[model samples]
Target: MYADVTVVGAGPVGLVLAAELALSGVTVQVLERLAEPETSMKAGGINVPTAEALDRRGLLPAAERVHRETMERMGAAFGRKAGAGAGAAATPSDGRGAGAQRQMTGHFAGMVIDAGLVDWDDPDLAAHAAVAGARMVPQRELEGLLATHVERLGVPVRRGVEVTGFEDTGDGVLVSTTAGAIRTGWLVGCDGGHSTVRRLAGIDFPGTDAELTGRVAVVDMADSSVLDEGWVWSSRGAYRRGPQPGRVFTVEFDAARRDDAENAGTRPHRGAPAEPVTLEEMQASLRRVSGTDVTLTALHGAATRWSDNTRQAATYRSGRVLLAGDAAHVHSPFGGQGLNLGVGDAMNLGWKLGAVVAGWAPEGLLDTYDTERRPLGAWVLDWTRAQAGVMRGDAKSVALREIVAELLATRSGATYAVKKISGVTQRVEVPGDHPLAGRHAPDIRLADGSRLANHSHAGGFMLLDRTPDGAFARAAATWAGRVRSVPDGTDAAGAARAEPAGVLVRPDGVVAWAADEAEATPTAVTALEAALHRWAGAPAHEPVA
Candidate 1:
């Protein structure tokens, strides 16, 4: 098969990127060894940034609805509010929906943020942000949703097709898979930690080694009541057993005992006996970690083991081959940010790759993918690594956990955790002096009462004008096919969230540039053109000077 781009792996990240490129009218193909979506939702959480990315693609409402229904039912079952569950959904009185809520609480390493101590909302900053909280959608279902969406966009995804190898011919990439050979302009490895594409491209997966092995399972318990529903930390280890009966999750941080099969080693047996795990072994680990008699009756499916081992690719790209998701980085899912981070990687890389493949992106635009995203990957790696230090059930770790929990209970302490864990604090560096520059633009309400993101479903830069002067419009017209000029209900500069006189939003929803509302000097117009040239490439006809 011949395509503009070939996405390796049919997981959520790969599918999202594929759909994104396809939506931009690019010919793309997805290759995966898994013929079908896995029945088990391996990942159960997605952060707010990812939620916003999905929203921009017009994919969030349906998934959010599914999540809301799930939460509503869970709320009924758990006797809690619809939005009280982890990564839950809540209806807001204002236009921002859940993103507008005032106070929220999040847990970091067994410690819950104290809402009374911390504002959680951070009103001053929340307005300009995209999403307020996360959505607890399972990986299996998320994959299904994205797969279906990509298919609808006319992107063909070939399952059970393992990408064995590839060669970057200095012009295009030649991909070899078990099914056959294919040609594409670019290839992205969205495969998991053990990525074949990353290996073929000779990228280094460097980071700290695993300090502990965490185990989880899906089984019928003899006495389910003994298993705790949410998260609980003890002298032994940490776990979150329920909120769904028979879907048991456990963790024991003892890398020392990983190889001993009797000790409940790492990785699942995939429901097969002697994949080096047993029901007896899982029960033992549970008892040892939980210090409870939570007996296992029958093992339905899971006997998987995970680790806090963190690794990241030295770089995100190798010639025509690029990496995303676990292929780019791997960490323990302790903070439940794996799906969120991977999805964010897709959002960040998708637009730049789409732009480059479409021939409108500036020189080195594709290079920025590695420059911008790799740092975020490294930060998350450290974030998860620090969480691991808090999680290990040991003398020092327990004492440290106590201190961390105490600090997290304070306003200053909780704010720090909430921002980082929620994926809310990222500000990718872009050229420009405006504080809003290089940040994800706010969800601004436009003149027609529609949100700014609504106009971005079709790709291209967006110029939201607040000034009466047609200067920005004149500038945007230079990049006719590249930038779309639109008017907002309020002045773009003084709009709801400290907006500028004008805002140039990248197709990926990042604020490329912001005009100073206070000044419309010749300098302002000149600055605007410079911003356009830097981001949107050189203007056509020099604005007919």
Candidate 2:
């Protein structure tokens, strides 16, 4: 309607997609039902991978203002267990339940630190001191920052507006909202787990059934000076003995038990406007497990319902309408990958959407969005499902967790998990006999007093190492209007690998082609031409219906 792209829902995911599109000069509109960002601390942490994505977009500094503060507080708690003189009360022994013992017994037992931020001495860490590691920004703060970033991009976000319906007109779609109707060439649904846009598109989210369990207490009590870190308290059955532990813990709350106890109704009733649960009920649950009176100043009510309904949509696109974030896939939040996964989807789609809108992409380029992301979404769903089972104390899940944990004790295993979960190991449509194919191009320092790392948002095909040969150089000259290249002398390792004298990289930072030095100059030129075609380097004027 008023914009080229209409984004449904103004949550963090939608805001990111909108900001990215608008930054690339796309006319974008974001519709949100909420009048403003929420104050609830629904989400507690952002893992390492998300921090990298934020850093790439240069939002890390502003994000750090909040992230660092929250992380510092979380870190203090986590560190207490590892700190000297930290007693068993602060630091529980290397404790394992059926699952933890089975999966991680004999595995390296040590304090866990953020892998992405592991190398504190790294130069980049020192340079970007503001956002150092997995930021601990609460859900509300994250939304606020993202919303502000979107507004600064000149994109208009309409809050308190709900999308009612839409129809595809073959060329564009007419989106009807509670506010008004608008027409847009494209749409992205980032409307969370229960998505209205997804329903309108008629996509099926099929998978395993959901697992419902747990009642949670979110108390804002005077900080328990003794308990700094988050801990789970457990007992033989039902409620634990006495006072609650710290401010957070997951306790089983069944409907039957609530009916038996006066204060243990279906939902918690604190002093809030909502129903209230007595401080005694909360304290008693904690005491049964930790044997302590976890003092409380304020109490917030929450309940947990885990679903194994690990789901992914059959497709991410339907003509002009598309989906991202929880709208496309959902899994248990055990590993805290839900938000990060959603953010990654937006990042991956953002560049492609820009290319398509700018007329540089082939017709099938948009098709790759579903092909690439849907599979990954499915994969993450599996991982989270497995992890969820472990969290819920399943014996089989515990055994599998222990096996994986044991394997992960090795350097190779840890590195593999680190890369996989970090989303840096992502690969896309790279077909060839080349060794670099299907692998992320390791960031290499160039010898030419320049580095590929120096480039900001280095989207599109990048020639990592270029040739000095006249024919090879001439080939690059031909694609000068399309790809960007640097001389091979820039990096020694890249130069050594240079045959036609350089390498071709994809927009997602994967190596596409590498030249063999033994090949003839003609062969090198031919290779360049082949790569140009493979990467859709033809002029943007190429017609598309």
Candidate 3:
């Protein structure tokens, strides 16, 4: 076998998965159809959970640098001063005191939600408060970062190599590529919405058809003054201008064609149109949506046409062939969830798949990836669907949008939206009832000023024991090889509840188990052992030298 695992696609998700597999001592390789990384602007930024995932991998510094550069360019294009940093709190222009800054958490449809309205004092939002917020890094830059990381990890990413077909023989998968045929224990498809791997694997992709066509482009215009800045909603559709100059976005309702007869009941060309976007199409889209005769003269970079084609895989895994990122689920780029969702998929699946390939995974461990992440993918599809519903030009949609806007203006509504959009409220089912259990562990600070994130750079489970007697640490010794014990964390971030004696954080940063007692009782110890067996697999059964 060339490698234990073969990942089809060299995007952020595949690179991340490859890196995790390499870190976990499993051989992995990535194959991408494109000879070079795409330079188009896809996702404009990442949400909190994605940012935290980068932080856990020690890539946040590079991401922050890229974010700052992106922000500076955006600020220059908009003729405004950039924020102090990528995740720094912005001071409101109106000077409405400390908490009044307009937090650009995200927008639902065209209505922007201000996270500033959220009560920071609320315990539910403590995890968000403990970490850096959302960031504006371009997708191209992020791919560069991940590509570099995977290269450093010695994972081979062979471009210009497309997977033509694959056969899963139960024992392993034989992947036929343009270069040659290779044998691998596992095959993961991260190749985007129209995945050849998914098609070859015969996984069912079922979802709603596209309703509207949206165009986003950076272009030179004959007269830029004809269009309005920011979001402009009309009876026709909606158009947004000048988050950066020359960058325009238009969404026209009832503009997308339904699934064609040949493509019906399968992965349709409903997301991005198969044709390359042109200046004439951009001008026509802007004219219809803005109700203005704006003329785009020339396209600057790549122009993209997208639709609200929402879909999710019936199953993320079929025998030894699996899927992640857009290959697993796809939806409208509304709420900027596509990239973040894909990154989340990579994070959630990487370690588990790695454990499986490394030969120490407990029974049914690999299946948990599908069980846990599929629901999140479904939720994202619905989230974007709701946004699409409110974005239509019809009167009913307008009325619904008004009500949603009003709800979003309220404290509770805004808080809920922020928590959901920022991913602070995301939790998977785990063994414990503790609030932190199954959720991403907060970056707890140790006595040495290091953080739980610091220990995760090497890709291992973390046992943050806060008990005075190091009870949890002692209990975790049997899994010492797979789980690192940090017994002296002070939780300076105050993100954890006062009672949690310890937290067993999975390599993906999700809390597998947490105990609230001051000391680790026999019951707590047993629970910890069970969690270890469940997540990190069986203990080493040998004393450390």
Candidate 4:
């Protein structure tokens, strides 16, 4: 009935958040509505930053294994097809196959990025590749792993229940769920787009209207090679064929035809729950949009009805409650940034929330969750909007798409596109003189030969000391239990990568502060104390036994 944090929704974001909190020694609970796990591979593809975040938590191997298995499954599915169509019987490219590109980092609108051409050593772009390129795994599989990890942390995930409502009691929150009521220090909603907790918290979800209706389905087609060989953009909309026999993806930008969904077929109206799309409706839509009589013999599973109606919560927090994932923002699924963005939110908020509960968080540390993540969410919204804007079936939009594609052919343009879409260039504004500060700290190998990631604790900060000066070490000793000092006055041999004299990394692996010049003077020690206080509150000053 009582816990440090109660997370609503057992999706990837919620499970990850709960697990992170529990890993930080915070008691947590997860409530999910569905009694069982979903088998459908809904969300797929995590960006490079996501891969890095997972690796930082020692979760990369499992995720990569899932991705490998999924790739094999897709290959098998394609192999059984009657005819060789788009990507059927295809051999792995160097990730760059001329006009037809295979994206490992994802795409912008429909323009996929060939990551092989990228310089992974570039500081701005390389920050995203700390664990290699982007990885793709089924959403269900990812959630399953998260659930397992959370279970390992002893966090109970109660399925077949949901957060019905809650009341903020100032000090804590009284959560009302289908199972029962409970009191928790904080409540976070990661319950997908149509979130019940957000409604209960009276959060304002304000955004744009849904102008385009879309559908993605798995079907048994009479002819595997019926669709085009590659991405086909036409007067109706854009369309693409997946790797398997029946997997077909389509979009319809015709407003008049979209309105017909309300009559009885597929009502994809804005501000309404997406109705179950019928096979007949999909067939009609495909035929109408493509103007080709493609026979869909059988529907493999339920079709996903999507729209371009992007919306984000006015704010991520409301008193004792907070929101993340689709609950906090929703947008067009042009590129698979949603999962990465949501999981990143969990990675950012988890430690902050744990810090607050543990009573070491600096002033406004909790507020920064909304301040930092909200803009990133809005940035994604704008990215998706821009993609959708150039993807309108109109001549102007189509022309713009062509221009964008042409521009993407250039090195700088492609780099820019990939950087933005891969979430590599995003740098948070932290109070520091060094450019690397407030950014993701460089992964450093300590003098003891341990990786920076290995020393990172879920609830504590890491101080990387590279200089052969004991000033930073002395200052760090004052906050020893709170902020761990990695190197003790170790010199050039202290780091695996070239780094500054001293660096303090947040639990989230972001550089809080770093010294530009190495000096074992009182000035350096004083500055270290100030930085330590600014980020982790006043030092614990542990008393000697």
Clashes of 4: 1
> TM-scores across all candidates?
0.90, 0.72, 0.92, 0.87
lDDT of 2 by residue, 1-545 (tens): 47789998787788888877875567898888767654432455564446545554556556656744553444464453211221111121111111111111110111121333233233222222222332555566787888787777777888888889999898888989888888898888888766778878888776655553333456655545534343342322122111223335443322222121111111111111233345655555555544556666666644232333467787899988999988888665544567877876786687678667767766676777787777778877887666545443346544665676566656556545544544555556556776556544544435654335344343445675444444454465555544666655424555443333566765544567766564336665677667766565464343233
The alpha-carbon RMSD values of the candidates against the true structure, listed in the order shown, are 3.9, 8.8, 3.9, 5.1
Candidate 2 weakest lDDT stretch, 10 residues: 98-107
Order candidates by lDDT, high to low.
3, 1, 4, 2
CA shift of 115, model 2, Å = 7.3
Q: After superposing candidate 1, which stretches have Cα over 4 Å from the reference?
A: 84-88, 92-94, 98-104, 128-134, 244-246, 256-281, 298-303, 489-498, 540-545
Off by over 4 Å in 2: 42-49, 60-67, 75-145, 214-218, 221-295, 299-308, 394-413, 433-436, 439-441, 446-453, 458-461, 469-482, 486-488, 491-505, 508-528, 540-545
TM-score comparison, 1 vs 2, better candidate: 1
Clashing pairs in 4: 261-266
| Per-residue lDDT of 500 in model 2 | 36
Off by over 4 Å in 3: 84-102, 130-134, 259-273, 489-499, 543-545
**Comparing 2 and 3 on lDDT, the stronger one:** 3
Instruction: Write down the lDDT that model 3 would get.
Output: 0.78
Q: Candidate 3 or 4, higher lDDT?
A: 3
